[model samples]
Target: MFKFLGYLFLMGYILIPASMAQNHVFVEAESFDNKGGWVIDQQSFAVMQSSYLMAHGMGEPVSDASTTVQFPKAGTYQMWVRTKDWAPYPKGPGQFQMSIDGKPLPTVYGASGNDEWKWYKGERITVKQLQVKLAIQDLTGFNGRCDAILFTESTDFTPPNTLDELTAFRKKQLKLSDQPMEAGHFDLVVVGGGIAGTTAAISGSRLGLKVALIQNRPVLGGNNSSEVRVHLMGDIDKNHYPKLGRIVRELDNGDPGNGNPNAKEYGDARKIAIVKAEKNISLFLNTHVYRLEKQQDIITAVIGRDIATNQEIRFTGSFFSDCTGDGTLGYLAGADFRMGRESQAETGESLASTKADDFTLGTSNLWASTPRDSVSTFPRLPWALQFSDEYHIDEPQSDWQWETGFGNYNTITQAEQIRDHNLRAIYGNWSYLKNNKAEKYAKHKLAWVAYIGGKRESRRILGDHILNQMDVQEGKFYKDGTVTATWTIDLHFPDKKNSQYFEGQEFFAGTKHIRVAPYTIPYRCLYSRNIQNLFMAGRNISTTHVAFGSTRVMRTCGMMGEVVGMAAYVAKKHNTTPRGVYQDYLSDLLVLVKDEPTPQP
Candidate 1:
């Protein structure tokens, strides 16, 4: 990960303790099928490291997951294990325990699930040179993947004095810290780690801003994750926006290689790998930002908490960007923003509410099932439509899915209903498979459901100009446009029956009979109305509900991030606020964004 020539003499520079003989070993283990030595389906995998960690379930969940790994030579040895959260509910972080000589360590749970491939460290402990054992546990109370077991001692180690060399050496290290022991004070702070947040962090850091990407969870790619489990429906083509995420393209394990054929899990592993390699990005994976300190519209410092340690920490940034889907930081910083639908009289949106509805479409917990693939019946919700094989597919090879939206209720209450609706949708499909005798898939069960909630609507930061559907329909182009949306004015309502209750028009499903072409979205929607020197991106951008529905798509959102990042860079260069770039230098901003060869993004 170091720059060119940064690796020279790096290996010998920082000498770390290693085994007396300086020996190394490799081991390979699969899910709990210890049939002979570590093997998958009885086939051996070439060992790359000295650990044959097992998932312990043949990739299935074991009723009791505690397993013991005998330590070879226990002199303050460090052990590494990886596992997936295979639970009915999505996996939260879990814990692992160490038992030496049948006695548990002082701590009940040793390490949580946050330590996946990115999680590494060295141990500082004194152990009698005797064989010992470690018992690992999943405190997260979920069942999933666990493997890549590694064990090593002080004698077998190396250190690098140079930052580049140190980063290179950290690839396999595993350890943990509780409080704000890690460094703080970043040059730029990205307040969300979703797609926009992730890109902003990486891009900003690559631009030489010591950036701290504050994400809610361990992984990046907000909606497109095992947690949210939503397929990214954005433009992957460069014709739309300059290929800002080619790195992401390289990382994606496309449809050809996904574990679940039914689940379209395409990921930009390249981008992820790059982000992980960035030294400037101090990724606080399992951390959340709490509050902020602002002086006259400028964020002086921000406060946050490491979820595990419950420790309060403060960080300061000369420049900050709000990528939080909810725009949490912008709202707190007294940013002027609008949420829900603005009245038609306000933004001139066709579907704008006469009276704004505070209740947005809300987030949904998504579920995906293959055509003909069904499982045992789940109890159907009262509102779920009954299946009579009414919906049909003529093509035999086409694999399709149904995404049913749980209508808005109380945000919290409707969330449960939405989840239940997803479950019901799964069961209803399953019922059709078994009882209805669908010949294609009578064997497929509920394949996967999103662990994190799939959000459709939330608080939108009120920007200087709340882009509306009318403007989009009229093709209100801005030379300084930051986002371009071609998708139609697609909207969804609760049910046909509840349509009248809504202040705005209902969302039509499937039919974009009047699908709109790509229109340039304005730059005003990227900053707050109330605060100065603040920027906003992603689904939370200031737009009337009707306009937001179309612009909220990830592709457009990604473009929004890229444009915003370029604008930020311009602002940084000019030493002005985001609006400053949008205004006086807008023509220049567009030229900068389009002309600058995208960083090795």
Candidate 2:
């Protein structure tokens, strides 16, 4: 007896019987009522099919995530948990247990010896009540994860293992619709909530445009948010465009050095407050844009799925901006993009490699520890990457240098692997220091470890003019030069000492900074070359690998967003495309840039 209720759009999940089919019940880990220390990880949702809950305690066990579920009937039911042993070589460090009504389950999860996500069957237990409390208890606190839990009565029932099969199964079970509900049309729809996207939305709103700022994560400021903890970099309002960086300054909550243990220093609330204050801006957090509708060369709308509930929302707009660091939106719309470094011959930059390769700047999962008054104990991790005195990084806390996924890994496809690799390195090194050098770090305890990896370089969306290294070094200025990038052309490679030990999967990074004068990026580099109605900012902006080193910083990226927003306003005012703004309304844009007003909250 199923009674249908109207679809709840905001909640993202359909109102269905908690017990589907009277014999089976599906519960998403991310939808837990009290998540405790567990974090929602959606980085691999595109591949894995759903966002899961992760216990990232560094070493110590974190608090349990608890929730209540309603069973169809109080009878014998078999339980299944979808999870993976992140490191299954010897044994997984990410170990955890599930409990019902405070009673522990017989089987331990996350150490099933399977490297991929699969369903782990649990003992059949008789349910004593229809509504019962459930909890996920962490064992090792070394990044254990749980995707979803299923309770079924059928003995032969097995959850789908394949991605396609699992996707269909989830839709069928959850009763999700094929069509997406419309999220109001806007003048400009920004697809990222980083410093660049946040600034772009604010800029467009201030310039009299209805803007929709959609961020995949719950918080704004991608890396600078409390989740990642990277400080804002690059000089703001330096030389060319004096009034460009005012919006960025509003969101800057002092430089909380990379991977700071104090979360408040990163200023998540301040950014949220400022964005919410904008009357013309509609902020959609925790919504990831996976697909888009492109008519001919113009993008008309984007389809985003809720990270937690899987509800898809369609955002229609006149113009769109690809601020996703990985160029996700642009790639979905079939825009031209480059992933790795360009060859010396291709870019004519001396810093470019001899030949084109997959070598790109790595991602960082920074961690920090504090010295406790009392001596602390850490478990020896045999399953983690072993580290010796000669090979170990003897540091109190990890910074931007603690990075992975350079030449050997794909930053987008293998992102979870990259993050897991960093976790292994972090835990392994910490274990070594705690065991071997106990006298020095006897009282040290891990305070914070980032679950969300801070990425440097990924897909660079191709635009009208690709910014190059020589352009920055030789002070090549454009008439349409809007945002001035002042950071040095700093490029990172695997550390020689670390490479000797870890080889291809080197975790430590070494960078050489080539000094450059303040160079203004051309307006042509802000929008896609072929994709009409498309604008891009952040690390994905059109740039050679060498030039990206200079423009990839947050402040510089934010300035690019400011320019994009201004251009969007002009384009909307004249009913022209992004390119048409530069070609036809160049003077109009320059006038706005020269006389930019102070942004109000």
Candidate 3:
């Protein structure tokens, strides 16, 4: 029977073929009917710009992932899979093979190739039946990955190697849309669903503006989400926007510690329900904004792709918010932004270096372990980086300070390298503790390890006024002061002990806490100087490296969101841009801010 299998299911952005060719098939690993023990990993999308299916066996071989495919023609076809050799060296730990109709392939892939993505070819075979089973069998289960598979009768055809070229190829082959589908028209569109973004959407919607909240992940709260598990820091309901932060308080996670074992502490379910209940707001999750459309200096629309469905949605809004911690939306819109540290000569920051440098705070893939009644055994890792006694993490639990990638790599561009480095550090440490000193870790088993690493700093989108360390130190109060940042100027650097052992490869970090009284951040630092209609909240807001230490906390970012939400309404009412909210309609916005709560219509 000729049937349209998973491949035929069309998303809004994916173009339906004019006609089906029975001999050629392209299967996305993530779209497999049955994933078995294989898990879908999208974290490296920042680096690889694509998602894949991985056999995360944790040092053990996992079950096979299988799918039923119905072939229209019983003819000879060549097979090829897009994957990476994680270990890259010969006879690496991670290895897997492809099976067709119960017959395993002769060659084992993903073990002895380079780290770069390439097509691993397989044998040409004649289909004996109209329907056959395709399976990916894991050999080692140590994180062998598969992005996609191609079965074609064309003997001379080869897939593109680079990301850009491959994207063009896929667009041509799949017949994808030249333009994205219209998602919706909104008074305000917030590009991130963190506390800052969630509150921004709620505030705007309650004030009678149609809002759209786009989140790349499945849940709200960004870094504070259960996946990352960082508790909300800094203060709310204090200073200028006393009444402004009621919304943030409504959705705050009450988790006392960073790596809470109780799943309920993350508040993922509660946030989804609350956002779903709001009538004026439209929330789109699992949608990543990768591109933007701008007319002159004003942002006209943003283009986002749904990771699961591969459907692209073009959101049109009068005003847009870049709350994505990476400042993704702003960067796409060509907003002026700064990455890395500025020199003391440039910003006159006391803590800054004599010269500018490309060093930013590191990222932490926080993890936790629980003590079980029975002793649990973890696999010994020979492929991981070795840690000396001085640098070894002796405990089973690792928190926020277990950070990496500061001077080692770029947190934004080289994200995969950073993630892999962090993973190696974690696995290497755990393996050493479990293997060498078994008795110490006998009762503890790994409970949770965040694959979605919690990032600290990336791009800081420059606004009309860039808040600096001097501003926080002197407590400079601007006439347009909106959000009160209360956290100390807490900066992080590589721990001296760890640095001594690992040198430039240190994974652990130590904080340099400089206490400061709460200070007001002006409205001028909330919107882009060049991008007229762009508004910003969260860690991406206009602040120098030193000043960001205080404003980067979740609560302060949430309050910034609250202010942006109020200002969005004023922008819509007065028919102006984000700058206009600070210039012409400051009084109207301040009225909304000072009041306890604006009555929801």
| Superposed Cα RMSD, model 1 | 12.4
The regions of model 3 sitting more than 4 angstroms off are 1-23, 60-63, 70-72, 89-91
lDDT of 3: 0.81
lDDT of 2 by residue, 1-601 (tens): 0011113543444333233654788888887777889989999876776788999887778899988888878898899999999998677978999998999987898887788989999889788888878899999878999988889999999988899998887777666677877777999999999999999999999988999999999899999999999999999858587888988899999888999999999999999999999988888888889888989999999988778767778889999999999999889889999989899999999889899998899999999999899999888888778899777888898889999988788888888999999988998899899999998899999898899989999999998899998898998988999999899998899999999998887999999999888999999999998899999989999999999999999999998888888999999999999999989999998887888844434
TM-score of 3: 0.93
Clashing pairs in 2: none
- Per-residue lDDT, model 1, residue 195, is 72
TM-score of each: 0.62, 0.95, 0.93
**Residue 566, candidate 2: how far off, in angstroms?**
0.6
Candidate 2: deviation at residue 508, Å? 0.3
Compute the lDDT for candidate 1.
0.52
Q: Say which candidate scores most in TM-score.
A: 2
Quality of model 2 by C-alpha lDDT: 0.88
Query: How high is the lDDT of residue 104 in model 2?
Result: 90
State the weakest 10-residue window (summed lDDT) of model 2. Answer: 1-10
Per-residue lDDT tens digits for candidate 3, residues 78-181, read: 98888877765344566889998888998787876588778878888788796778899999867788888778888988878788887766555455576876
Instruction: Return the candidate ranking by lDDT, descending.
Output: 2, 3, 1
